[model samples]
Target: MELQQLRYVVAVAETNSFTRAAERCLVVQSALSHQVARLEQELGTRLFERTSRRVRLTPAGAAFLPAARQCLEAAERAAAEVAAAVGEVRGRLAVGLIPTVAAVDIPGALRAFRGRYPQVRIGLRVGPSDELTEQVREGTVDVAFLGLPATARPQGVVARELGRDPLVAVVAPGHPLAGEPVVELGRLAAEVFVDLPAGTAGRLQSDQAFAAAGLRREVAFEVTTADSLMARLVGEGLAVALLPSRYAPRLAGVTTVAVADAPERVEYAVWSRDGRTPAATAFLTAVGIDPEAGEARPAPPQEPPSV
Candidate 1:
């Protein structure tokens, strides 16, 4: 019936508990219940059924939840668009970065963005590429930097190539293959591999590559962080891991090799594929480096070399 009423209903539908939804909505439990009752009365259907142990959405509530969310989101975006016109990109801009991208460029990119936009609140979250894509689709992030595969992309996400970060195999210094002059994925099929958890974009790519080569792969160990992966690779000599080339330069005493037949992992700028906003436009321009612009912009003058 009203925006507040819609919000109350949506919140209750999401949390499935009036008390919990009240906490999320920052209102008292009694007030939330009253509002939801009013909403149900208007809709001619009960949104939630209460029980001693738990709460569940009724059939009517399940059907109306998405529309409620859409209404709120559209109103929020509309207000944000108007705010953007005044030359201020004010609002919390949530950004999602894949682990590899976060490792290499997030700091630099954040520095650049913050220097230009001190007023805009910036929020950063890092995860694997697949998770990052899901966040973008859910509107959990305003922009994302991820290793999205070029084949199939998530719906409603506009991906612009930021750059390609090559994936290299990392081996411990004392390992048998560490000093090899030639490195190939085919040979490493039997060697243990340290992989990010399943469903990660990087792991997905790695798996697909192995599949293409007609090989079955196994993970010797799984690590969630780059540092942990590097430590495992360097200290145990237990398995070889593939990560962005940027991380390769930082891990000392590890043998990094280029995968000859593997596809180069690509990093891209992902945003809501709909609507234009100054913040989004400015961000895209700041990060976009055309891979084929034909003309190289003149470099900034460097200090003369020390005599």
Candidate 2:
């Protein structure tokens, strides 16, 4: 009737004594005997024959013993499988990557991760930084690689720094400033700029830099896609834009020059506090970042200057 009753039946049959079965089951002998008796009564059959000298199983008890053992084994195996699933890092993990993040070797890392956790299914999504940040906040993606502004930290998210990508001036190979190690914003104000839209973090950082210098840049072309295409356009001498130095596409005719006193954008591995998963943690570990230790810390406050 009950699983414990079946276990009692199996233990008694194996030991040939209710006293030993009670010891094995960690219960009193009378309690074990009463449960077995209750089980037999519920089945309307005599499961055991009791004598003053020995306890023996009837033919019916012998027939039911095997099934009871099998049932207990099934229960044990089910519990083990569930425990393994929970204890081991094996499940579907969704990761988001911004197209402009070029420092992380995602393909190489993923190949290695697959080799280690073959059972973990990896799903990847590539997009701009804004969308990826939103995905991390919404719990649609387990983790994301984002190009966030220098001082920008998203709410309800934990971010680990992968690298710093400073905004740089990228020009055609034949351009005059192509070989310059660092160019001032005042000098670049006259150049035809291939810049991102007004609202993007990269564009805003550039705008702020020019504002600090009291300069205005002439936007010759505004690009929406911030990946290799911007580099290709710069390579063709269409227009020079301010782009992250790390993400400057590997184009033959493009040259990247760091902007003097430019604000550096940060690349972060972003994940929600509530949505962290074992698979996500494993992936973070694979990339050499400890998810537990990489909790985002508040920036230090600035000291007031003496007038």
TM-score of each: 0.76, 0.65
Evaluate candidate 1 by giving its C-alpha RMSD to the native, one decimal.
5.4
lDDT of 2 by residue, 1-307 (tens): 7889999998899888999999999999999999999999998998999988788899999898888876875564455456457776665678998667755777877998999888777899987677777877776688888876777755568878776666778888888888777888888889888877877765777787788789998887787767677777888887888777666644445787877776777888888876466677788877767787884333234222111
Residue pairs with clashing backbones, model 1: none
Runs in model 2 lying further than 4 Å from the true structure: 1-87, 295-307
Clash count, predicted structure 1: 0
RMSD of each: 5.4, 18.8
Candidate 1 wrongly placed segments (more than 4 Å): 102-104, 111-125, 128-131, 134-140, 148-156, 180-182, 197-200, 207-218, 222-234, 249-262, 277-279, 285-307
Top candidate on TM-score is 1
- Alpha-carbon shift of residue 282 in model 2 (angstroms): 0.7
Q: Candidate 1's residue-wise lDDT over 72-172, tens digit each?
A: 86776677678787766655577777656622355775688889877667788877766777778777677787775445455567766655555677888
Residue pairs that clash (backbone atoms under 3 angstroms), model 2: none
